[model samples]
Target: MKNNLYNFTDKSGSFISFSAHRIKSLYLPLCNEILMSSITADLHGDIKSGQNSFLMEPASRADLSLSKSSRNFWVYVNKDQVWSAAGVSKNI
Candidate 1:
């Protein structure tokens, strides 16, 4: 089965999209949380690489946790919300 495609949008009406293959190549174990973290890291790296600020706004609570690492920037959607993480990636 083909992996799901993910889209990232900024507040300035600009957006970039990526396929699961692209994500997998960058980050091992393409699980949802890992993918989200990968996306945030990639985005942050892109911004830092360009010497610009990185900003992310996840549409849902599930998408927000990827940025939780101390190495990454974290922006939570809500304090009382919770989400069950999905399956782990089998292909390492």
Candidate 2:
């Protein structure tokens, strides 16, 4: 959990930081949210993943439909309007 495959850090090693608290409290939850939501779609027979994902967009936290055009990807949507959250898949 200390290291991640995803480039959550800056290459120049400046202007950004992945503190242990951030990774555990923020980053990991986001990645997990994608998995949770994908599970929701998969239950209905639509598999979503990196290969079938979307670019992050300012979509409704509860918005449905993952789209793509020769470059499919899931949008990293926020979980709620009042406060940003993860584990939104449970709502779907």
Candidate 3:
């Protein structure tokens, strides 16, 4: 059974709907609402992890890493900066 649902939108403003069950077998836990919702809710407020800032060119060179756990959470960063938003790119 599906634990969640997703409605995807493209840059053109078009959207498509799909059942999470379709991909659940692949073991993509990000589709699980119980897990996803908790992670999202926890990211709110004054938590340092939720606060994101841009790093300049020199600062960008410092070794940066993210845990698999954090990779599942929503985060926004400047595309041109060291840490980038999940799927955004500077060229876009």
Candidate 4:
């Protein structure tokens, strides 16, 4: 593998999730219910650590520096998935 190469995968969730509570004023009961209901059966069990299924927050340089254990959960957003949701891509 070469440097600068980013093989982003679910093994490493979102760094922004750390600041989940900072951005409030929304509702997410459905997500919490679904997650709790399917804990043992869920593929990624550790996701519930921070319990932030739909939280988005701005991260500072210090926040991003946190260790792996400090993270909430790992999220995998791949190219194929992106293109599928966004339709075909155009060449530059």
Candidate 5:
């Protein structure tokens, strides 16, 4: 199950930028809850690990979801930044 973290638009038609903290604290917990709830009815028990199994692709699919114009203005991450988010699995 892939999840897209997009810019939330307010009711007044203004785009609201969600802080990293908000994503980590609020949205992540909600995602965890849904994932946990799904696990309960998974007959095959496909979940090998727990909630931590949820992969956070900080600069891939999520980035693509942005508007094309927005993407053009994106600052690229350096090697260290990539390592911090992806670690050894990045090579794979």
Candidate 6:
């Protein structure tokens, strides 16, 4: 089956959309809470390399998590709130 796609939109209205193929066994520092892993996604309808995944650290570390089943997910973050929707096929 094809992997599900994830979309992230920041407060500035910019978007970074992608899908994770295989979650890395090792984690790289993204911030105090989040880490980097190997994944791939489409940027402007073009498939990106596996090295293109970066998880942003949320204000509350407990607000987010990632795993193999994390597909068709939408994440919206701002200074006040962190919102996410899973198993949905829509864009912000």
Best by TM-score: 1
lDDT of model 4 at residue 57? 40
lDDT of 6 by residue, 7-66 (tens): 546777454435352432322223323333322221111111223542332212122233
Candidate 1 per-residue lDDT over residues 1-92, each given as its tens digit: 63246443677755454553344224322234223223332332111112132343422323433443323333333675433222222321
RMSD to the hidden true structure, all candidates: 13.4, 14.5, 16.3, 17.1, 15.5, 14.2
Candidate that beats the other on TM-score, 5 or 6, i.e. the better one: 5
lDDT of 4: 0.29
Which segments of model 6 are wrong by more than 4 Å?
1-68, 87-92
lDDT of all predictions = 0.34, 0.32, 0.29, 0.29, 0.29, 0.33
TM-score of each: 0.20, 0.15, 0.15, 0.17, 0.17, 0.16
**Alpha carbon lDDT at 17, candidate 6:** 31
**Candidate 5 local Cα displacement, residue 66, angstroms:** 30
Better of 2 and 6 by lDDT: 6
Instruction: Kindly list the per-residue Cα lDDT of model 4 for residues 1-92, writing each as its tens digit.
Output: 54232333466642223333343321122235444211111111133324454233433333323312222333335653322221223321
Q: Candidate 2: misplaced stretches above 4 Å?
A: 1-39, 43-54, 65-92
Residue 2 displacement in candidate 4 (angstroms) = 22
Q: Which wins on lDDT, candidate 1 or candidate 3?
A: 1
In candidate 2, position 20 carries an lDDT of 36
- Per-residue lDDT for 90 in model 1? 30
Error (Å) of candidate 1 at residue 41 is 5.4
Model 5 has an lDDT value of 0.29
